[model samples]
Target: MATKTSLSSDDWIKAAFRALSSGGVQAIRAEAIARDLKVSKGSFYWHFKDVPDLKAQMLAHWSSQATDAIIAAIEANDGSGREQLRLLVEAATDDRNLAYGGVRTEGAIREWARYDSAAAAALKAVDQRRLAYVAELFERCGFCTAFSRSGANILYGALIGLEALASGELADLRADMLALLAALLQGGDSSQA
Candidate 1:
């Protein structure tokens, strides 16, 4: 175990996520994480003002690692928007590509959002950003604004729903997500659908 003085803010945040994945939002206590980290609560306080502050930082870290980083990576590759969208689908469903722990962490965060205003707000912001980015990709694929927005909503919604339903291996889920992406890409314009 690392010494208290050696623990960084990211270490605390990651331990908190592990706790969240195993338990729930209620389990993300500084003392509990400190215990798990084999550090003093003073280590947690050294990095955060309090538990709420840690929670806020956790949310920020999650948003950056999950959404922002994925988008940046996808954009870094040279591909048509259609190709990029396909990559996005793969990344979203691939358990190995998960930013934090995996589906459990996402599920826990969503569950926390149900009753926590800050969590809910963070979720809303992340959703909006994801939807907008997806919509932009759709537009680049020749879809009109309305169709792009609609497709984004459907695709993103399906991803979230799949995450909620996910357990153990995600082979079937990846296939299902790829099939959905193909269907969305092949579907006609908004006027026809």
Candidate 2:
């Protein structure tokens, strides 16, 4: 239990996310998070009805923060479809571009989805929504139906790869992503991975 402190639902959620990232979904247990945060389990119950509730909220938070919020922001901004695509890629790789930003651990969440039905469903919805948005943008940019879909898939897959596998400094990865994005948009060779 946290000594001499008060914690909100958001605080518990943040701690849960950290736990999830470092120790996988199993680490999201309420008692574990409370211990990690040095807060009483009562504090957790105050915010969530139970572990399942927290998991549901956590998935909802992940989807909204990582997908819905980002898409809404990009759509609200004034820019061409291609420019929006660039921004989308930028936000995915670097949370600094977002207003409601925090440490991103979608890679861990994706791994969790492999074992948990709720997580899997949430991830599926996010994937479908995000891909649909990308396909729409590609269409707006004048890509043929097949090409636009292929472009969306390729772009989304590349972003996921970077999230899961890319190494090196943040700056280097960002630069490399930009180069890859350019090549992909131009439909040029990108076999140098």
Stretches of candidate 2 off by over 4 Å are: 1-6, 96-104, 167-172, 188-193
Q: Estimate TM-scores for all models.
A: 0.89, 0.85
Model 1 CA deviation exceeding 4 Å by range: 96-99, 168-171, 189-193
For residues 28-85, what per-residue lDDT tens digits would candidate 2 score against the true structure?
Answer: 8988988877877777888899999998998898788778999999999789888988
* lDDT tens per residue, model 1, 1-193: 6776788898889889888888888899988999988988888888999999999999999899889999998999899989999999987877653435677787888889999999999999999999999999998888888888998999998887777667555436678888988898888354333
After the best TM-score superposition of candidate 2, give how far the Cα of residue 12 lies from its true spot, in angstroms: 1.4
Cα deviation of 133, candidate 2, in Å: 0.7
The CA-based lDDT of model 2 is what?
Answer: 0.76
